[model samples]
Target: MGCLSEESPSRSMKPFVFTWNGALALIVKVSIQPCVTLFSHPKEMASSSSSSSSSSDIGVILNELTCPVCSELYKEPTALPCGHSFCRVCIEKSWENREEDTGYVCLNCREIFAQKPKLKKNVIVANLVENMKLKEGKVWLEVEVQDTEHGDVNVKEAMKSGGSESFCELCNGEAAKRCVPCDILCCEKHLKPHQQKGHKLVDPGVKIEELRCIEHGKPILLYCKDDESLMCVTCTGGEHQDHKIVGVEIAHAELKDVLAAKYPHVSQSMQSVASQLRQVQKEEEKTENSSRDAEDSLEEKGRLVCQFVNESVDLMKSEINKRKMEKLSLLGKQREKLEQQMEDLRQRKSTMDTALQDLEAISFLQDSKDLLKRLETMSDFKSVKRTPLPVLDFSKEENNLDGLIMLNKNFLEKIQKGPVEHPEKVAEGPVEHPEKVELDQNNLRRLYGRSPSLDPNSAHRRIKISRDLRTATRTGTENQYRKHPDRFDDFLQVVSRDCFSSGRHYWEVDVRSSRRWVIGICSNSMGRKGVESGLGGNPESWCLFKGNNEFTAHHNSRATDLSLPGDPKRFGFFLDCEVGELTCFGDSRVLHVFWGNSMDPVKPAIGVYDGSVHFVHLVK
Candidate 1:
């Protein structure tokens, strides 16, 4: 391109230069590209200004073509696997100068390849750069056309030539259309010739140059499948002649369909994974809540136990103080009586002394009469015995108090440290014979056996208790028993006199004579006067019942049928207060068991609806 320059200092304008920092310097020499010439004519100057703007627009396009390594329009541009294009010579030189350990690397991205990779030509960048260079030449031609001065220029022609539009390749006029096959911009006059020559014409706004091949400068007609590159007709006739190829549109549509088919499954899998993550999060939250609740429950129970023990200790202390005050009061009364006796004795002695020391006969005679009378009284005083001293010893009470304290302390310690083990008992070997085993086991359990006598106070009105209070018989006639608060007024149920609150104990009842009977344990707080308080009718009691030849275990108003063979002559109950279990044993096997976690005291109970039931003496 040539430019005529007539220097004028007054009209001089600085040339605009585009610069990008941090890369190789890009210096494009298109001087006076957007500067007005010394035309003077307003119409010519306006056209010159329009040409300058078009030229500046081309400057922006050239910036994209600048290479990172060379900072110039791409020359034989090659692409690395990192998808960055660089001048082939420039990239080759960069890799050669790099350290051996770094391997072949892309200059722009620094992406490494283990071995030297083969370079691939970037047709898209190359074609775009070439098209911009051609467009720049046309822009210079337009500037040359607008530089010609004329006195009277057509207003319509100037207006039509005014804004930024692509220029025609042949005549440098503002482009009206683009030829797709030739990748050429054309004015209206040139478009007809191109159309007549069978070239495809499209709107000037369409980027026909982008679809053109770099090698042939023709529209891409085919996709070389093997090479995975777009090709022009000339490319197919060359090296890609025998390679698998298809129309570019066909390849594009097929690839789009493939992507469309895989998209939904991939999306669904992502959603499923997200759902599982949410479920895991919910489970984690639930587990945390459960753990927190368990900790709170443990803390609350510990506080309650401590409070109960403290209250019990306070009550015991109060009782002891009361007894101490009673003993002190009795001692005080005895002291008052002894003091009165001493005072009477001293007065009698003083009168006798005064009578012995008197010198006057009259005073002596009067004193003697009084003294004699006092002596007579004193003679009666000899019969008056001194009040015996109240004994201060409390040895028995002290021993009992110490034992009670130790027992409570041991119980608390056991709760904190778990059950205590007697090493001597644990060291004993097991019995060999089955019969001996049973005997020993029974004997061991009997160590805690209680001879529970039936409480006459708790017996029903229709129930008759023997004199020994061991057996209770249910008769048709009501006994003349007085109404008592502890009496079982509604049912023929009576509890034992002894209540077991801690440790383990076993008791047996002889129910062989009874055709219908119920034997079990009941809490001390169980109702005694109501129909709801029947043997196993409420939550406070549990029992094994035998009536009409059917055996069942009942608790909380719920009965569970038991399969027992013959009549069970005797029933043994083993109560473990700490473990909260009650096991009922028949003659040879266990009938059923009940569980209660309460710390309340429970007593062995017996209910006879027909015949009599006796409390068996297991210990004796």
Candidate 2:
């Protein structure tokens, strides 16, 4: 940290070199003089000794007093807390626009503080700068800055050294004047010869050699465009002979102007790029969080769906077990009855065996009448017959489960397709039926008439649909129909292909030939293979049944008798699905009405235990 001086004689002398910002240049000289310095001149560095060394020493002093900021000699030199020094004016200017809370920073060490510190002059550095300027002989401030491409350039500033004392370049004696063009130091006695050649002259210590070319020993007046170098007249005729050239001052000014104009835009582009980089980092974090959330949501839905399917399976298993237990109980009772009958027959055989053992004629004769009566009774006695095995019906449960599966499948598919454009238009399924309303008998056949055809696939083995598909007849022999899932297996019934969900319909049936008949509507979900599948035998069906000289309306095994003045062969049925009402008409009167709201997609059905019924088209 200490500068080299005559006082440090005991330490080995070496060059004190350091860097300034990015430019590496020699800053000190290895000498014992109080202000010793040296400059490397290619031509006369070793030749000039005593007086040249004295001048070089002054240059080193000037460099030591220079400030890092402004690249100028320090004016009012001030030292920071970190021991580095700068010009008071320059340091204050650097800190001017900075925020107070951000504190001040040292440009050299990049040290920060909580508040700006007060600045004061460093007396030691100031005294050295003033003393070097007041040296006895004329001195110049020789700041040699190195250029990577062109080598060293002398950035010399001339200053007075207290008096008019000067020295000639060749002789160590008093000098009176200087020649700017020839770079010669001359006394008054030798000044006339240079003046005769019209060379420009100036005061002693003036640095005219700075603008002169070192290689050619001539003033540098022009700049070479091709080589981008400074050139003298002699150099233009050498390697730069064919290159384009311009005045040095012109090129220097133009380059300065161009850089000044472009700096703002380049700086703005750099800041914008930094901001976009920050935004991209934030977006990356957000994307990671969203992906995790999506995974969690998917896992939750999968768990719920799996649970629903498991519950449905358990319910089905429970239903099967219940039906199986009921059938097993019935078989157990039948077995017990058969066992009792066998025991009674065994007891009678044992009594007859005992009586046969009596060999006495009187004893045998006395029991003969009673034994004959008992033998006759035994011959006439009838044992309990074995009942046919019961068939457990699961068709209705299967149909309901099938419907549920289809509903869920449709719902999942709908959601998977993406957002709905018109969510209000989506149907939620068949709605509950409304309150019942009466319909005029006159309009039953005219206003809302429909002609429903029988489905041959839904008919029982003994119930045959005619070729026209309008009539269903109960036959003694079974028909050769292909097996189908919807075919009736136990009941003599056939439903129409037509069905309704929400509307009104009217149809007529010609039942004159059928003494026992059933006609109405049944839910599409009703079981097809059970005794309960007969018309009006379960909650899924409603019908007007006629049998045993009685006309009745039946639903869920509950029948309501209806009295009519006379039996009319042609029966008209009016169904209002929205209100869940079915009205049967005979002889221009409402014969009976069936009401409920627990069914949907009801189709017209007909069952005949004897004879046949014709579906008549009443719509005009």
Candidate 3:
């Protein structure tokens, strides 16, 4: 705490100040207090220099170079005509502090200049101070000892971790720190010169290679965006001219933002996938439990059905087991696909974790490209679905074969509802229903009416099909249709139940009470939206149109006005697919004939406007 002992090691090392322009460059060699000395008399300095000078003698000479005014090492030392010297800037400071500039007596000679002495660097003294400091540094630097607290420096691990210091290159011995500007390691003994200005010292634990540019051998202080590589200042103009470069800290901050912005999307995806996996796990568990419950229920109920029918119990069990085997076979295939997808997702999760753990900026972004592409295939990974297992259908009363099971009309329903009550008594022969739809007097209704039901699923949302499904009415307001790839979203046309490819088919649409109507056969590939969707006008449609008592038949969007005598109450539409021919009759008289080339099956379609049109089917 007080002045160090005169015999202390600090006395051997003195301040060696060098001026770069006018800066007072000081290199401190002592770990404790500095033994900076005041300027002494000539005889005292002579006595101090009496000893035989060695390589370390520069220390004594440098100590004597301290400024007479400031009592510190010479910094920008200047001389007056009186043969006395002081630091140029220090003398001015002294004059200002004492407010004695006009009497400006030299601190050593007590002689005043006519005015303030012109201040110029004492070049000779500056050079001597620098050369002596260099000698002194080399002499003392050869004797420094390493601190024992930390273990031997690891150059390799230090390089990998990135900082500054490691082992010295000269002797392969441990060092205390690294000089960044030199990009070299120095032991405590050879580190003094590196501790001065124009050099940067960093902790010895840092890696040398990571901080220096490989080509220029300079510290990587900036990032080069054009090359996606780290670089040094010299790289911007030399190798990467015109390329985008930013400070390493700035680039790191921006790239961190780029990665952070994707976090929400990645987190949501993980949550969604995890939820789906949990659902699959629950489904597997439910299936296992369901199988056990089903076996128990069937065993209980099989006894009742077998006893009542007087059938061999073993035969009935064999049939049930056969059906169960068939269903299990299907479920097995589905499960195989599901498990494969699950394994794939697991692998993707592992890849994601590895990518996240990689701290290297280059590698992390590079690996993410492949990861993103892999994610594309996972968008449709659902394959665990299985059809509901079949159960005994008891809806067919009295013809039940106790020893066998058949997939019947309500087989799916029974699975959902549990087995229906066993039929009252399995009847011996099948009962026939004599009920039939009445035909026209000419036996024509059977040909035209498969009960021409409009498919509501395919109709536009604005259209309201009748309860019996024979009529389609459109509300005037144009509205959006339910989303479907096949449904017409822009037009008002409805399709029928069946198509005929090679038969001559006849049907009658009665539009006597309608203001505007269309009856036609539409190709299966007709466009459902836009101008091309209109009945009788599109290339895929042919229709007979009635508007304001005018009749016209259109094919390929071109209309041919029919010269009928009057509006026909019922228009007879006939299509012969084998010849690609269509004919229409008004009042039983041939009115028009349209020809098409393809022999593909076609469905009859109808559209109405302003009033309703009826599909003329016979009632008994």
* Candidate with best lDDT: 2
The positional error of residue 356 in candidate 3, measured at the CA in angstroms, is 99
Off by over 4 Å in 1: 1-441
Name the candidate, 1 or 3, with the larger lDDT value: 1
My TM-score estimates for the predictions, one after another, are 0.32, 0.30, 0.28
Root-mean-square deviation of each candidate, in angstroms? 18.3, 25.8, 35.4
* lDDT by candidate, in order shown: 0.65, 0.66, 0.58
**What's the ranking of the predictions by lDDT, best on top?**
2, 1, 3
Report the alpha-carbon TM-score of model 2 versus the true structure.
0.30
Predicted structure 3, TM vs. truth: 0.28
Winner on TM-score between 2 and 3 is: 2
**Model 3 clash tally, residue pairs:** 7
lDDT of 2: 0.66
Is 1 or 2 the stronger prediction by lDDT?
2
Error of 3 at 488 (Å): 23
| Model 2 poorest ten-residue lDDT run | 24-33
Per-residue CA lDDT of candidate 3, range 1-620, in tens? Answer: 12222342322344322222222223323212132122223453355433212222232333345553333456777877765567776566444423322456565545666576677777766654554343334322221212133343332333234332355643344767776644456677556654432245677777767777799665565677778898765566566766665556557988999989998999999999999999999999999999989788768766765674465445566766787898788888888888898898887788778778999999888888888887776645666666787775533322234112332222344458754332222221111321221112132333332345676666776766777877777667754656776677766668876677764567777776677878888887778888778887766787888777787877766777777677678876666554466656666556766667644568878776766666666441
lDDT for each residue of candidate 2 in 34-120, tens digit (9 for 90 to 100): 222344453443443222333333333333555544334556889888776778876775565243344677655557766787787
State the number of backbone clashes in model 2.
Answer: 1
Give residue 398's lDDT in candidate 1 (0 to 100).
Answer: 50
Error of 1 at 483 (Å): 1.8
